[model samples]
Target: MIPPDNQIYIIIFSTIFLGGLMSTFVVAMVFIHRQRQAQSRQKMDQMQVEFEKTLRHVENEIHQETLTQIGRDLHDNIGQLLSLTKLNLNSSKPEKHLEARECVNEAIKEVRALSKTLNLDWVESLSLDEYIAQQLQRIQATGFCETSLQSDRSFAELKKEEKLVLIRVVQECLNNAIKHAQPDRIAIRISKNGRARHIEIEDNGQGFDTSKQSNGSGMYNLSKRMETIGGKFSLSSAVGKGTLVNLELPFSV
Candidate 1:
């Protein structure tokens, strides 16, 4: 009952319709791919913002903790010295009064020493050996754990950022070692191999599985900070073998 011309027209229309459908599907796939790419970019931007915010937050927290400890040391440790000085000043004998003056001078010296630590600019300028010595002295005073430092070359030639990162990394490692590992001895070593600067913090303490949540936020932050500065971070630890945190930073000069 169909005419030949009409049947030919039907076939032509069907072909055109299928071609349009395929074109539409191709366009839709392109749109989907672009959308996914945009989403991925947004996620990366958000993560960068969050990481920076977290770093600032943690830095402020560390500053506050340091201030609090300094306050306690001044009060409990130095305050007693002040009290003794006052007692000597109130003595009935002249010799005792002279002794009190000497005591006062000693206390003032101690206060000055404590005051220097309020600002870490000196640390930025100090050699790695000197910085480590100061850190070790402070750590020893806390009776938390013993620390040692060994270096093949002086850290005076290193960049300021490198020194700060190095100190922060070691501080985080030592903190974790004391708080989590409860270590008896912590050792820090630094050396240069060709153009690479190598640093290591090792502790003989109760270690945890590195594959798990062993390092915590402090260590994680340090790792991220190191990566930002073109450095490599690695950690090795076991239940009884203790922990070893290592960092390698490329040196141009």
Candidate 2:
């Protein structure tokens, strides 16, 4: 056990063993790091898939809402008009006959226009800015308010999912402005802020305290939709001041 030659061999063997242990530990650390990275990438991919699926679900909901609106218009407004036309056609006077024909023609035109909206694919074909403008036009047509749109489409066209969620958010904002705010004028501005897209909808309507729900104007739903999309939504208003809605979304999902 006290041989000098053997002692030297023992020392050499210990050094080699220590070196191997260090190498194994280093390799283990690297493996752990790589495993964590893989898991993170998988999580992100899964989230993206889920986000897209949610967008499709929301799109279907919007389509259904549109269908309900069309149904009500047909049953209430168009149905009444058609009934009047029928009654006028049975009248003895020739003047009433001419008026009946005009009424029937008007109802036919409205039905044809509504038929176009019955198709779901029509929404996907429209650009984001175009869709927003159409919504604002509908509000203006109601004569409750005057609305304007200003958008910079040259910045970057949004992806389909991004546009879908954001459109609903914008719609909610517009409806809130009309119902709760009751503003005579509404201005919507859309532009880019660095990599984020900015949308501001300001109205001169009567303002209410944000702490209150404001008669359940669907503010919660708007905020939730924005959160789902990883976007920011903020509102500012007072008792006398008008309401301003600010929404910011990243360029890509």
Candidate 3:
């Protein structure tokens, strides 16, 4: 049997030990919480950096494409009109001068139209369906292939960044079809399925094996870009069957 004084001392020691243990536990929990918060912040910062990088890349690509289109129009359309205007002006006939004035007016209009496309604001103003239709029309105008667009026109509005990324991806797909597929017919379909928007670009060209590794990084890069935008990209192809690209994006509520 312990004496009363000894009992008091034991109780006090036990109380002090328990209090110290609780303090250590609380400190450990707080440290763990703060460490997790720091990690979360770091991850979010890294994501923002990557998104900015992608945005810059998309902007550059769009600018380059705009320049190329402008160059083509200048050489093919505007230049020809100017040459005709010069020829008409050189003629002695006053009627030819009137014709020359008409040509100049037409050239002015074309220039104004081309100027609108030069600005990135057009990207924001154009809907995805409209852009796809325009692209198909351009291809058809080239007589490269028979192009078709089928759309339910139920596309949700997207942020400028999201729209830009989507436009580039679609452009890349179309280019790949023209360059590699050599398909006689290219068809694009846009639709909405439940909570997602779906686009399928299909080519009736020579398709490659999906199981085999691609010789280039184009396919891999496309997949990654879609992931960055919270979208999904899938390519299905088989020998002699042709290639189809499926793009899916969730509708933000």
Candidate 4:
């Protein structure tokens, strides 16, 4: 109903307004997308930092343990050889000489045992199950626990880093029970279900509330370690029901 000139002006204004709105929407979306990408990158960087820290800590501890083991082996095995040699020098009879030679052979046998016991190459190459069994055997020698292991041998499939973390977790937990809980009995059971491996360490000791009681760094470290590897950890305990630690690790599809 209006003049042709006015109608043209109205059309022009409408077109400009629509164009401005579309442009603004696109700019806003672009900004949001960039922000999201930056946040994701920051999260990834943080995780990497944490993982590296854990790896370094584990490596340091392993190095220290290896040194201690080697020292013990030398002192217990090779040191005895030196002692026997000195003892033989004190005796001059033919029978004494033969006995000294026999002692040397025994010492040589012990050196072989040392080589078998201190083999770190197996630690690096073995499966998780094998590593764990070896550890438990060492622990069991203390008459501390009725430990048992059942596995699909999938542990060897784990990366070296993963196996190290897992080993540390088990060692820490067992140590805590022995040092603090004074538990009379302990049991460890491991198994794999499909792509996930499960661990249950139960102790019949004086239990505490994991939420209220302060476990200091050990408990916190255990939880954080599991989380880093796409794993879950749970602790359940009562005043007298004892403590049970459960862990689960899931693999990427």
Candidate 5:
């Protein structure tokens, strides 16, 4: 057997070895935890950057659309009014002068209205359903196709970024339907499905096969955009049957 002094030394060495081993393990675990935290932070930063890029794109598209609408209004509505006002002012009759004044006033009001749409503030001011209704009404006014919005309940309020993304997606869907579908009627229905809200845009136009890959990147971009906003995009179409596009958003999101 070993001497008493040697046995005490052995016991001290064993305890020190075990303590050192535990210290190394704890250090390793802490390093792993900190590394994972850094990775998570990096991922969050990337997502935030992507979301900001999407918001910029949405803002640009909305500005372009607003400018186009303003151009149309100026050419078709305000321009005519100003011309009428000039003609009435040139006339000798006092009644004609009064009509000219009225036309000028109406034109001023229209200009004021158009000016309000020049900024991105409208995106935050308007609700989703209200915007949808306005879009459908604008389409119906064009007489290109019959458009309808059917909603029994209001949708959940979304953040400004989510609203912008959703509006852009909806606009793209309507544009595709009008440009390619050649449908007689386009119907947008909004409904609440349990914990989610659904917006369905259906057109009675010539539908293409969904199984075949699309040559355009529009659908893929739409899906990505929806995913960014914690939403889902679904499209169904057949060769002879009509096409339907559905957008779903969870209430918790």
Candidate 6:
């Protein structure tokens, strides 16, 4: 309204203030973006570390189990076969010699099977369903209980780490059934629906009361383990009817 020179100075000041505000806004946005990126990277690194730790734990467990199995096989299986072979050879009958040869052949076959199982790397080539089925078959072969498996799909889509975790879980369930439940029959079912993978293991055994079986935090540990993997674990049992374990795993898309 007054001097023209003053109006030009006013316009210059307004432009400077607007430019400073724009610059500050850009700097703030960049700082926030960088902060979020750092947080994401930290989270990813932590997950990787956890995964590696789990893998090592599983490997150690498997190694210990393998050693036990080898000892059992040597004493119960191969040793028995060799003893029978020696007895047959000592007999006067020619037919006994032939039986000795057959015994030796069976012993060799058993050793070969054990050798394959001794190799931890062999697990890498197996699917989760196949691994579970093998364990069920072994349990059934014991003649102490009848075992069955039902699977609608293959579980090759799961990561190796996931499969290892599941293997330990299944082993625990089987041991509990045999050691405590004394089940007459056991059933396992595996399936996938949408993004969920399901495993159901049921046994018709003399079940104990779930309310009072807190000797060593066994059940609690299993539940915590599943939660760590973003999975769900449940146990159902009665005094005499049976026990059922249901596990659900969510898969990444």
| Clash totals for all candidate models | 0, 0, 0, 2, 0, 0
Quote each prediction's TM-score: 0.70, 0.82, 0.91, 0.82, 0.86, 0.80
User: Every model's Cα RMSD, please?
Assistant: 5.5, 3.3, 2.0, 3.1, 2.7, 3.4
Q: lDDT per residue, candidate 3, 93-172, as tens digits? A: 99999999999999999999998998798887899889888989989999999999999876647878888889999999
**Per-residue lDDT of 12-120 in model 2, one digit per residue for the tens?**
9999999999999999999999999999999999888877777777888778878987998799778988998999989999999999999989899889878988876
- Model 5, 1-253: lDDT tens digits are 9999999999999999999999999999999999999999999999999988988988899889889989999999899999999999999999999999999999999999999999988888888888898888888888889998899654647888888988999999999998999998999999988888899999999999888957889999999999888999999999878899999988863
- For model 3, what is the alpha-carbon lDDT of residue 1? 100
Error of 2 at 232 (Å): 3.2
Order candidates by lDDT, high to low. Answer: 3, 5, 6, 2, 4, 1
Candidate 2 TM-score versus the reference: 0.82
C-alpha displacement of 22 in model 4, angstroms? 1.1
The superposed Cα distance between candidate 2 and the true structure at residue 121, in angstroms, equals 1.8
Q: Which 10-residue window of candidate 3 scores lowest in summed lDDT?
A: 153-162
| Model 5 weakest lDDT span, ten residues long | 152-161
lDDT of each: 0.77, 0.82, 0.91, 0.78, 0.91, 0.86
Report the poorest 10 consecutive residues by lDDT, candidate 1.
Answer: 54-63
Q: Following a full C-alpha superposition, what root-mean-square deviation does model 4 have from the true structure?
A: 3.1
Clash count in backbone of candidate 2 = 0
Q: Which candidate is the best by TM-score?
A: 3
Per-residue lDDT of model 1, residues 1-253, tens digit only: 8899999999999999999999999999999999999999999898778656645654555566568868987898788878888898888989988888887888888788778767666556578777677777788778888888888863557666566666667667676777888888888888888778888889999888767764447666777878755788888999888999888888854
